[model samples]
Target: ITGELINIINSPDTSEDEHLLSVNFIQADTKGPEFKTTYNSTAQAIRIEFSTLELVLHQGVVLR
Candidate 1:
């Protein structure tokens, strides 16, 4: 399948440059959900995932 070829081309070892991804400003309508991810220091492989939160508390946000 074409998907397999694309995967082979995108394999991490093919690139000398570091790959980085960031997520920001995710909001939810409920409360208290956990957040996490996993990445190897060697950069051989990586996976990232996160769950949406209902209103992440901040340092300066005024609460009613």
Candidate 2:
């Protein structure tokens, strides 16, 4: 998956400030892979990576 982050700043003298971040993820053919999170304050970005299976059945699974 891919995503972007933006930070907006407003000021009287300045018009506007924006910060952008882009990220991508790759999946492996493995089981029970661990993931982690990262934070960047200056760039105003957060990233997370995880591995899981996505299934699409005729009827969706029910959750309680």
Candidate 3:
């Protein structure tokens, strides 16, 4: 119930693995919603961002 949520970002347009990045340890629970990311791109760089809050109408448990 308490752990890290890992996100991996990759683009087929980029050939290098060094271009990849991730964000971790984001908190989530049944009582609250989950957060996600957005991507912004320019000619030189790609930016990833996470929001402060998310709204989920129902809380479901999934395990893999």
Candidate 4:
């Protein structure tokens, strides 16, 4: 008979999810109003940076 060993994840807080740990992938799900606000703000910042890059490219073309 073949059997796979189970690895338990020990933490300070005890819970049922801790017992289900094994040598497998663990997907962490993080979702909330704060996360959404931060993500949207980060995307907006990147968009602003790219828009400035376009200005630099236009300047280079004009300088040529």
| TM-score for candidate 1, residues paired by index | 0.19
How high is each candidate's TM-score?
A: 0.19, 0.19, 0.18, 0.14
Compared with the true structure, what per-residue lDDT tens digits does model 4 show for residues 1-64?
1364433333344455453234433222245455455454232232111111111233433578
Instruction: Sort the candidates on lDDT, descending order.
Output: 3, 4, 2, 1
Q: Write the per-residue lDDT of candidate 3 for residues 1-64, one digit (tens) a residue.
A: 3564533332445445434444444333434332222212212333464433333332333332
Worst 10 residues of 3 by lDDT: 34-43
Give lDDT: candidate 4, residue 62.
54
Better of 2 and 3 by TM-score: 2
RMSD, candidate 2, Å: 19.7
lDDT of 1 by residue, 1-64 (tens): 2343222122233234433333444433232232222321232333464333234443433343
Tens digits of lDDT, candidate 2, 13-35: 32234223335555433332332
Model 1: colliding residue pairs? 28-53, 28-54
The better-scoring model by TM-score among 3 and 4 is: 3
The models' CA-based lDDT, in order, is 0.33, 0.34, 0.35, 0.35
Model 4 Cα shift for residue 11 (angstroms)? 47
Better of 2 and 4 by TM-score: 2
Off by over 4 Å in 2: 1-41, 59-64
